[model samples]
Target chain A: MAGRATPWLIGLTLVLMAAGLVGGLWLAPPDYQMGDGFRIIYIHVPSALLSMVVFAVMAVASAVGLIWRIRMAHAVTAAAAPIGAAFTFIALVTGALWGKPMWGTYWVWDARLTSELILLFLYFGYLALVHAFPDRRTGDQAGAILAIVGAVDLPIIHFSVQWWTTLHQGATLKLSGTPMPVSMLWPLLVMMLAFLCYFAWLLMVRLRAEILRREYRARWVEKI
Target chain B: MDSWHEFWTMGGYARFVWPAYGVAFVVLLGSGWAAHRGLRRALARVASRVRGGRR
Candidate 1:
């Protein structure tokens, strides 16, 4: 169903990403304090946000699959797992790079960092459970349960900075307002949107391939 | 030329800044390529199965 639209989505994602990079790396002014090092925020923040957003998406898809007994929903959970993991990985590495210059250490055993690491592990665990079972249905069920359980970490990751005295700074962008100047904020916002588009594009492509694999024996698939 | 050098230097934090972006670029691109390859492989397998069944 989404085959024709996939190419268009990829094109749109690329354009937005290019605009975001230009806005972030070139147009945005250097921070008064951190100077150009703050530019990493353009990549780091969007990646960190997507890390959690993708997990929430996977958890919701897994829940729906469990409730509705929909194979396609399970396929979506499968498709989203590795992408979420990749974002989580990027967030960690970029955060570390930012940390070393700002925090003077590569890592700290802080609440936010630890919780984000756990989120990566959660993704790995889900992927493992999905493949562990002999029957695909059983694998889906097992993976779904693990995904639902792991969602408890999302709030923990979000609130960690607030609840603990971590080296990591408090939220840069909040519901009320961000302290960032308009020049910097706009690029960050654009980059966030670009990353989101990239995520959606990947999810759609992976979901199509997953659905095809799962339904290869069905009449509709044969028609394709 | 001076301004270009400053841009690349990233105010002396270039070591940390460039690698962060580089890794993000590589990981995202690698995953996208892998996904596309997976789709092609699935299509090939399905086509073959259908053809074999006909025979």
Candidate 2:
């Protein structure tokens, strides 16, 4: 099933990403205040959003694996960790780049920035814990527990801008609609969708790999 | 042609803007490549293991 779906997912991701980039870079008007520097938000916001979303996914998958002893659920947690970490890294680097022009610094020890950085570390911790155990089952269980525990950071990361005075700005895209013009907003929306598709594609690929590794001795694996 | 140059300049913040996009592109592409490579390696390992077990 995954084998058939992977190509379609990759194709969709590429198309959407290209469209999003063209729209953001050319069609969208520059910000009144930040000018073209604001274009970084096209990628930064999507990466930031995905970093949290992927962690939430990992936490939920970990919980499911713990409760039901589902190996596939654990595999999902494993598959998502490195991808989530990558997104978090992108979010930080792009954010720093955005900050230097707008905020006049590459980084600040502010609430929003700090919490997001913590998220990157949490991903690292989960990956390390999972691999540290000699036994695969023990490793999965330990990693799942760590993932569940680390989920507390998600809400903190989300509300940090509101809860504290920070150089980092509040959410531009909100459920209540944004003050941004339609021209700029549409491309961001497209980019967000593209990132989601990219994540799904990567997840499917990694999950397949994780499953194969775990089940290499099984009869089904031999058939594949 | 000058218009294209202006687009690339990104309104004088080209240094900041382009690098941000560049980093995102590299990280996303790298991760995708890594995931694909991992899948291929796993497949190869499984194939060898299965053959060995049968023999």
What is the CAPRI rating of model 2's predicted complex? medium
Q: What DockQ does each candidate score versus the true complex, computed on alpha carbons?
A: 0.70, 0.77
Poorly placed runs, candidate 1 (over 4 Å): none
Those runs of model 2 whose alpha carbons end farther than 4 Å from true positions after fitting are none
Clashing residue pairs in candidate 2, if any?
Answer: none
lDDT per residue as tens, model 1, A1-224 = 57787787778878888888887787888888898999999999999999999999989999999999988899999999999999999999999999999989989999999999999999999999999988999999999999999999999999999999999999989999889999899888888988988898899889988989998888788876
Q: Give me the candidate number with maximum DockQ.
A: 2
* Tens-digit lDDT track of model 2 for A11-34: 999999999999999889878899
User: How many clashes (backbone atoms < 3 Å, residues ≥3 apart in a chain or on different chains) does model 2 have?
Assistant: 0
Among these predicted structures, which one has the highest TM-score? 2
TM-score per candidate: 0.97, 0.98
- What class would a CAPRI assessor give candidate 1's docking? medium
lDDT score, candidate 1, position A192: 90
Clashes of each: 0, 0
